[model samples]
Target: MRILISLCLALGGLLSLPAFALSDSGQQALGQLQTRWAEIRYELPEKQREAAFAGLAKEADQALASEPKAAELLIWRGIILSTWAGAKGGLGALDLVKQARASLEQALAMDPKALDGSAYTSLGSLYYQVPGWPIGFGDDEKAEAMLKQALALNPKGIDPNYFYGDYLLRQKRYAEARAALETALQAPDRPGRELADKGRREEARALLAEVRKKLE
Candidate 1:
């Protein structure tokens, strides 16, 4: 959990705008995953998150098995796995992150712009959050590049901006972080995602408060 403070604190929502290519079955499966994921992520107790996310990750895996070609499902799977790893924590979490990275990369290869470039958002978060060198493939440069690409694709997206701002805050670029986070706060509400939007705004506000303190 501590390993992903930057991301968890910054995560708006991994479930992105609909992908037109998704089959009816895949869309249904993704909807179920989306609703459950949000509930577990925002409403579940901290102690229960590891189990909840772990179970959901497996469900995501199952969903992908039925629609191996759906980039949206794969992206969500990556997000679920990444958050699962965060909730699990410790040496055991390494394998989950690796799997998450693989899923995101596959989604990017399948469709770089799928889900409003959500694969980029998840991948960027993982790159910076995971360890580097012998431990994992975490790279600051790669993270920044991927994040910037996400921003280019969806400048008004809450997740990309929040994650980028979080990354900037981590890099000690407080002023830029504040600007990015403020942009996140200004993102328009996403219809049918009021809960997620509320949660994301709360996160952005919390992080913005931190950024403001740094500015002072």
Candidate 2:
């Protein structure tokens, strides 16, 4: 009787568990997006990149549709749209950038700590990289604040450090930029992210060279 009672108690506990966390299918979708994004960002030729990003955007859209409030899905969608804008530059790209900004904003609202604070890093990059008044909503102060928040959340993360470094370089804070870039270069590799790690490290090295020139 005691054994049977314990079994029922365990079953009751299992049944009471919350379902707010990501489903297995949602996790799988996020992994697929990461893999495909890395391939598009690192392996695809420049002429083919925009088309690839369009496909990624579609995949992200589907993933979000399946799990509308999934913070990770929203973050990936934002990233896909942002990269698509960069690949499809011109007046047309402005709309894509706006959409990307909105997606990231929503993700931030949902879960600011999701994906190691990736939403903050990407949004910060957009703020500094885009145009200012009359064209876009770029603002150095906003960018600085977002990037600093991202760094605070993920002090040792590669993307946050690299982006912060790039922003510093653009602001002509060469010394600080170089320091951040160096830290990015030393970041640990993530599983299933070999291509991304290689590409980002190369970018950091290239930018570090430019920073060195400015210092000299």
Cα lDDT tens digits for candidate 1, 1-216: 234422352233334444436777887887787777778778889899999988988899898888888988888888888888888887788888999889999999888888778888899998889988777789999999999999998898888999999899989999999999999989987655666678778888998999999999
Across residues 1-216, which tens digit of lDDT does each residue of candidate 2 receive?
111000000000011112235688987888888888878887888799889989989999998898998877887887888888888877677787789889989988987878777788888888888777787788999999998988887887788889889999989999999999999998877777777788888888999999999999
How high is the CA lDDT of each candidate model? 0.82, 0.78
RMSD for all candidates, in order, please: 2.8, 13.9
Q: Report clash pairs, candidate 2.
A: none
TM-score of 1: 0.91
lDDT of 1 at 53: 88
Show the lowest summed lDDT stretch of 10 residues, model 1: 5-14
Error of 2 at 127 (Å): 0.2
